[model samples]
Target: MMVDEHENHTIDTVISLLDILIIIQIEDDPIIGIVLVALLKTVTKDRLIRILLILLVITLGEVSEIKS
Candidate 1:
Protein backbone atom coordinates (compact mmCIF):
# COMPACT_ATOMS: atom_id res chain seq x y z
CA MET A 1 0.00 0.00 0.00
CA MET A 2 2.81 2.38 0.78
CA VAL A 3 4.51 1.51 -2.47
CA ASP A 4 1.33 2.20 -4.37
CA GLU A 5 0.95 5.54 -2.70
CA HIS A 6 4.54 6.43 -3.54
CA GLU A 7 3.99 5.49 -7.18
CA ASN A 8 0.86 7.63 -7.30
CA HIS A 9 2.74 10.53 -5.79
CA THR A 10 5.48 10.18 -8.40
CA ILE A 11 2.89 10.13 -11.18
CA ASP A 12 1.22 13.19 -9.71
CA THR A 13 4.55 14.99 -9.64
CA VAL A 14 5.10 14.19 -13.31
CA ILE A 15 1.65 15.46 -14.16
CA SER A 16 2.28 18.60 -12.18
CA LEU A 17 5.49 19.14 -14.14
CA LEU A 18 3.55 18.81 -17.36
CA ASP A 19 1.01 21.30 -16.05
CA ILE A 20 3.80 23.67 -15.09
CA LEU A 21 5.19 23.40 -18.59
CA ILE A 22 1.76 24.20 -19.93
CA ILE A 23 1.44 27.20 -17.67
CA ILE A 24 4.84 28.48 -18.77
CA GLN A 25 4.02 28.07 -22.43
CA ILE A 26 0.66 29.74 -21.92
CA GLU A 27 2.39 32.63 -20.26
CA ASP A 28 4.72 32.90 -23.22
CA ASP A 29 1.83 32.41 -25.68
CA PRO A 30 3.42 29.39 -27.28
CA ILE A 31 1.38 27.02 -29.47
CA ILE A 32 3.12 23.77 -28.56
CA GLY A 33 1.96 23.81 -24.95
CA ILE A 34 -1.63 24.05 -26.09
CA VAL A 35 -1.14 21.12 -28.40
CA LEU A 36 0.65 19.04 -25.77
CA VAL A 37 -1.97 19.59 -23.07
CA ALA A 38 -4.76 18.80 -25.53
CA LEU A 39 -3.04 15.56 -26.54
CA LEU A 40 -2.46 14.61 -22.91
CA LYS A 41 -6.08 15.22 -22.01
CA THR A 42 -7.16 12.93 -24.85
CA VAL A 43 -4.81 10.12 -23.75
CA THR A 44 -5.15 10.11 -19.93
CA LYS A 45 -8.13 9.12 -17.78
CA ASP A 46 -9.61 8.89 -14.26
CA ARG A 47 -7.46 9.44 -11.19
CA LEU A 48 -4.25 10.91 -12.59
CA ILE A 49 -6.03 13.05 -15.11
CA ARG A 50 -8.50 14.34 -12.57
CA ILE A 51 -5.71 15.19 -10.18
CA LEU A 52 -3.86 17.07 -12.90
CA LEU A 53 -7.02 18.90 -13.90
CA ILE A 54 -7.70 20.00 -10.36
CA LEU A 55 -4.12 21.17 -9.99
CA LEU A 56 -4.31 23.06 -13.22
CA VAL A 57 -7.56 24.72 -12.20
CA ILE A 58 -6.23 25.70 -8.82
CA THR A 59 -2.98 27.05 -10.23
CA LEU A 60 -4.81 29.07 -12.83
CA GLY A 61 -7.20 30.43 -10.23
CA GLU A 62 -4.31 31.42 -8.01
CA VAL A 63 -2.45 33.10 -10.87
CA SER A 64 -5.57 35.00 -11.87
CA GLU A 65 -6.16 36.09 -8.32
CA ILE A 66 -2.59 37.26 -8.04
CA LYS A 67 -2.86 39.19 -11.28
CA SER A 68 -6.06 40.83 -10.12
Candidate 2:
Protein backbone atom coordinates (compact mmCIF):
# COMPACT_ATOMS: atom_id res chain seq x y z
CA MET A 1 0.00 0.00 0.00
CA MET A 2 2.77 2.36 0.85
CA VAL A 3 4.54 1.55 -2.38
CA ASP A 4 1.38 2.18 -4.32
CA GLU A 5 0.94 5.54 -2.62
CA HIS A 6 4.54 6.45 -3.33
CA GLU A 7 4.14 5.51 -6.97
CA ASN A 8 1.05 7.65 -7.26
CA HIS A 9 2.86 10.55 -5.66
CA THR A 10 5.68 10.15 -8.14
CA ILE A 11 3.26 10.16 -11.04
CA ASP A 12 1.63 13.33 -9.74
CA THR A 13 5.02 14.99 -9.44
CA VAL A 14 5.90 14.01 -13.01
CA ILE A 15 2.62 15.37 -14.28
CA SER A 16 3.18 18.62 -12.45
CA LEU A 17 6.65 18.88 -13.90
CA LEU A 18 5.26 18.23 -17.36
CA ASP A 19 2.67 20.93 -16.79
CA ILE A 20 5.39 23.42 -15.94
CA LEU A 21 7.37 22.37 -18.99
CA ILE A 22 4.36 22.86 -21.21
CA ILE A 23 3.74 26.35 -19.88
CA ILE A 24 7.35 27.29 -20.32
CA GLN A 25 7.42 25.89 -23.84
CA ILE A 26 4.31 27.82 -24.76
CA GLU A 27 6.05 30.98 -23.72
CA ASP A 28 9.43 30.20 -25.29
CA ASP A 29 8.68 28.55 -28.64
CA PRO A 30 5.65 27.48 -30.63
CA ILE A 31 7.29 24.33 -32.00
CA ILE A 32 8.22 23.06 -28.55
CA GLY A 33 4.76 24.03 -27.35
CA ILE A 34 3.19 21.70 -29.93
CA VAL A 35 5.52 18.89 -28.95
CA LEU A 36 4.77 19.34 -25.27
CA VAL A 37 1.04 19.34 -25.97
CA ALA A 38 1.45 16.04 -27.78
CA LEU A 39 3.44 14.68 -24.89
CA LEU A 40 0.83 15.88 -22.43
CA LYS A 41 -1.94 14.25 -24.44
CA THR A 42 -0.18 10.90 -24.33
CA VAL A 43 0.66 10.90 -20.61
CA THR A 44 -1.89 12.94 -18.73
CA LYS A 45 -5.46 12.43 -17.58
CA ASP A 46 -8.47 14.40 -18.81
CA ARG A 47 -8.57 16.47 -15.65
CA LEU A 48 -5.02 17.64 -16.17
CA ILE A 49 -5.79 18.51 -19.76
CA ARG A 50 -8.74 20.62 -18.73
CA ILE A 51 -6.67 22.38 -16.14
CA LEU A 52 -3.93 23.03 -18.66
CA LEU A 53 -6.45 24.32 -21.16
CA ILE A 54 -7.66 26.85 -18.66
CA LEU A 55 -4.13 27.88 -17.85
CA LEU A 56 -3.26 28.14 -21.52
CA VAL A 57 -6.24 30.37 -22.13
CA ILE A 58 -5.23 32.60 -19.29
CA THR A 59 -1.60 32.82 -20.34
CA LEU A 60 -1.97 33.00 -24.12
CA GLY A 61 -2.63 36.72 -24.19
CA GLU A 62 0.25 37.49 -21.89
CA VAL A 63 2.63 35.24 -23.81
CA SER A 64 1.66 36.83 -27.13
CA GLU A 65 2.50 40.26 -25.85
CA ILE A 66 5.86 39.03 -24.61
CA LYS A 67 6.61 37.69 -28.06
CA SER A 68 5.99 41.07 -29.65
Cα-based lDDT for every prediction: 0.68, 0.65
The collision pairs in model 2 are none
Candidate 1 collision pairs = none
User: What TM-score does structure 1 among the candidates reach?
Assistant: 0.42
Instruction: Count clashing residue pairs per candidate.
Output: 0, 0
Give the range where candidate 2 is weakest over 10 consecutive residues by summed lDDT.
49-58
Query: Model 1 over residues 1-68: C-alpha lDDT tens digits?
Result: 99999998998777767666665646546576666666666777766665667467657756886897
Superposing every Cα of model 2 onto the true structure, what RMSD results?
9.4
Off by over 4 Å in 1: 28-68
lDDT of the structure predicted as candidate 2: 0.65
* TM-score against truth, every candidate: 0.42, 0.43
lDDT of 2 by residue, 1-68 (tens): 99989977886676566566565656657686666666656765665564566367447756777898
